[model samples]
Target: VLFPGVSIDECEAFTLAFRQLSLSGLADCQVVGVGAVRGEVVGIGGRRDVEQTFAETTRPDVVLVPGGIGVDRTAHDEALLSWLRHVEPSCQWMAASSTGTVVVAAAGLLADRPAATHWLAGAKLAEFGSAASPERIVEVGHVVTCHGRISAMDVALLMILRLTNRQIAEQVRIDLERAHEQAAVARPSWWKRAVALVRPAPRGPVRPRNEQLDTSDWVEMELTAEPSSTTPNGDF
Candidate 1:
């Protein structure tokens, strides 16, 4: 995964999780960075310090870049854009999250594709000739994208689904507690029944065993033990 610049959320969302689940095992296939700027940016520390100006890294089967302030700045960077251009042809698959789509779009890679990006930058996506949608995850050909932060998780699952099968994706969904929020692939009208068969129905709410407490049923009273005064009342 080549993050144009370091972004902690993007690293956590894709890189950390990919390390946990990828076939190459945790230590073998590591997440590398190609830093666009010099200064440190919080949690996104020294991953792969690309001190030299943007140049294509090793050819990757999958290239992923997630959105952040990094995307906003990297869009106009000539060298970074040049590096992306070099990698585009060789990458088997490419994906972006949130505003990172802006960088991808600016690279002319998402043209003629249905892309997803932050609602705030929807127009920016269009400016590059990509069809931007409000959908959580949009996959046009080998390119995948998500519109915002929460959809980062969805983009990861979709990548897994594409590489594996629906069954594995379903299992991962259950394990991640993401089945309820998993984005659905549009199916043919006839296949809708098949989709229904695979997907469980929406869960019904759990009912409480007890009824509401009625405040009116409760009583307020004031009582005094006046009789306890006994002989004391007669005496001074």
Candidate 2:
């Protein structure tokens, strides 16, 4: 479910990934939006109407909380935190993105656990008992947290892998990548040019060698390669 001031990109990443799975017959799942009330919740880029309120919704298999500027207010919301505390135990997974981790932490669900959050919010997260991790994604037991907005895609893909098989997850990844490429091609000329300017130049194809290296040659190459520097304490 989404909260007010949600990150549209993060919200869509989870929703769309699951929608794709259902559409492809890879899983039987439904995505629902729940709000404090039965109405619209304004998001960063857009607005979404929730079908159910906190009281109307049932327990879900997975729960996602996405971060945005609105989290500043939501983090302290006693009602929402109460609701989260109510639903957390029976959930198969509890995931949060960016500052959304703050909300989850505030709910008292992350005590003494390692979680990922926006780098800037690490100190704030620590106030709630979770050790903020530097990694892009951190999973502890059933809780998963991602470091930034874009990592929502990674979270979705990981969920797909968990809910289905690796093969199905791979297919979904390929489909998403292809769709992204198509969308890039459809962008306006100026936008495309701006992206092209920032994009790294494609590497040239490697040429195949006619001769194969023998075991002795491999050993010699490894021995001649520059030795890695070691620290004073003897750690590499």
Compared with the true structure, model 2 gives a TM-score of 0.75
- Model 2 worst lDDT run, 10 consecutive residues: 210-219
**C-alpha lDDT of residue 202 in model 2:** 63
Candidate 2 clash pair list: none
Q: Tell me the tens digit of each residue's lDDT in model 1 across 102-168.
A: 8888998887676888778877887788867867678778887876454665565555545544444
Model 2 CA lDDT for position 196: 64
Model 1 regions more than 4 Å off: 1-6, 23-28, 36-56, 70-72, 165-236
lDDT of 2: 0.72
Pick the lDDT winner.
2
Q: Lowest-scoring 10 consecutive residues by lDDT in candidate 1? A: 214-223
Shift of residue 32 alpha carbon in model 2, Å: 1.0
Per-residue lDDT for 1-236 in model 2, tens only?
67778877678865676676777666677888877888888898789888878887658777888888866688898878988898899877788988999999999999888788888888878888887887878888888898755566667666666655556666766666576567545645787678768984465523432111101232223234454353111100
